[model samples]
Target: MSGTERGGGSTVDAVRAWRGLAETSVLLDGFHALKHALRFGARVPVALTSDKAAVLALAEDLAPDVTRPLETLLAETDEATLRALVPRLHPTSVAALAVRPSRAAQLETLARLPRTAPVVVLDEPRNLGNAGAVIRLAAGFGATGVVTTGTLDPWHPTVVRGGAGLHFATAVERVDADRLPPGPLFALDAEGEDIRALKLPDDAVLAFGSERSGLSEGLRARAEHLVSLPMRPQVSSYNLATSVGMTLFHWASTSGRPPGTGA
Candidate 1:
């Protein structure tokens, strides 16, 4: 089999594999996304690129660690075919399909005790982009996981795109507020205690409300403590992702662990 072959099969076989797995797999769009996913131990079964040589060059320059794997996994295909496989072909002209982590495994990770990092919770977030950004932030801060309550699928393709393949770096799941892992729930609210005066615990469940409305009644009821981010009096609220970033920064700053060092 040639390097251009689909993990030992032909291009046709690669297309077939993509079609077979598209519905079940996570779409890793663009070179950076694929690189991040591969670095984080995501199982990429199929990867396609319009220009395998160029992509290999990119890996050589930016990600020497995954260069060999890219050489083996990337199947060269025509631009039109690549476009057909993905709704929008990334500017880098590379895309891949990665196996979504099992829900049971993520839940197990979330439920484990003595967590060294906080778990971020989005209370009924309405924006897919915000959810994705939060996941990215959670992954960056080495948070235990990112949990979302309400309708938005934490693993939605749009969210995945926004996350830039960092979802595999941390646990992500859509669970109700009651199902959140073992931790003291510190819900973010304008009326709560000033965050600067408090020391966020490693096992804290940092919850933020939706963009339009504040925390849902159910989540607010479950919260043991309410915390507030510092803001000017006239400002309404921080963006969902921004709030998560600030909270995680505060946690990491005081937790004695560098960001990105998982517990």
Candidate 2:
């Protein structure tokens, strides 16, 4: 099969399309990533695999909902050619390029009002993997979005890979602390109102500090309430992503609506 011919196009056409969009597109590195992205309505222009049959089989077993689209989308190429395109080819031997959502669109999403779920804010997070995990958590909890304050691009490839293509499931963007969405700010800290005693509101803006530091002075200043997760005396702090997961869970428990159900 010289590139799983489809729509009168061959591997050459797919490779050319991949190259054309490589710089401007988000790379869906593996079968699962592609699967999740497609489920969330990502615009995947080109999907390549060394074994189209295997990819389709995996999809049939794991995500039958997307199987037809995968069948129509996937283009098979030689393993060597596929590896050349993606240096670190995934074990599943599938890769694709998806259009990255525009920053303007994401900003609009983050700014939308009447939010039925809390928006998770990562204050100056330093770890790419942690940022990705937080995005995944936000998607799982049906949070309004995940906003990062700092230099790290939340949409970086490493972060996206960590997110397993769920970036499409939730709104994600980087913004200055002052520009965060409209909500009652709640910053997590060691010394604050005990989280157990306070019911986190659905539209709350839950902010967690970086791994090395608790909270930035700017973020702390903006917070209307300082919330603390329960901890024993000796423990210093929780992981950034872990802290987010707990806080969002707390909000979901009290919101009287199921997570991801949408208000």
Candidate 3:
């Protein structure tokens, strides 16, 4: 019998649950993805692995803290079974499903005032990978959220795959340009003021134009400050993800770090 139909509703129970929830749930693709998601408090309903010993070894080597919980959660199944469940198997050979946060909860978090970190705004972003990379950066830098003002779903499966399941670490959502959170809007533009001269505020909305065509007229009009990164004379613009990394690093250097963190 298939692992999905064996035992006293053992792994089969969990596997069946995963199958039922897969369409609506968030897929945690690999070992690292599952690890990060669990660490960040994602509500994972089920996890399956081909080799529990190997995954546990990985846990022991990299994340000793989660080993006990993983022991209770990981359901051991054969390779064929795992391959049948997940479309493309991860190199580490592990997969899981977690609950996606509600739009209402994300909206509420984004709208809350007295914000400590900046909210990253991707104005009409076209690339899914770029948006995912931006979300990963935002999470690493402790940005309040990563908001996209465009048709691209920031939480698409491809983007989620690119993000390595770090979406649970921060707020990510899509909304119209006019509905962005309350903060000082600092939009990045080629003709704007030099970024080095100013100290970005804690509650700033650090906005970046899309990969192509730059910001829309409506978004540009909403910008309180137009900031520019230092680029050579001939260069037109940096890659969208690279630009966000540079800008976020600047924010971390100025406000996110402790007074003597590196020293």
**Candidate numbers, best lDDT first, in rank order:** 1, 2, 3
Ranking by TM-score: 1, 2, 3
CA error at residue 82 for candidate 1, angstroms = 0.8
Query: 147-252 in candidate 3: lDDT tens per residue?
Result: 9987999988878888888899889999988999988999999999999998998789988988888989888888999999999999999999899989988888
Q: Global lDDT of each model?
A: 0.89, 0.88, 0.85
lDDT of 1: 0.89
Question: What is the per-residue lDDT of model 2 for residues 42-140, given as tens digits with 9 covering 90 to 100?
Answer: 888889999999999999999998888888788899999989889988899999888888899998887888888888999999999999999989999
Q: Looking at model 3, which ten-residue stretch has the lowest summed lDDT? A: 1-10
Tell me the TM-score of model 3: 0.93
TM-score of 2: 0.95
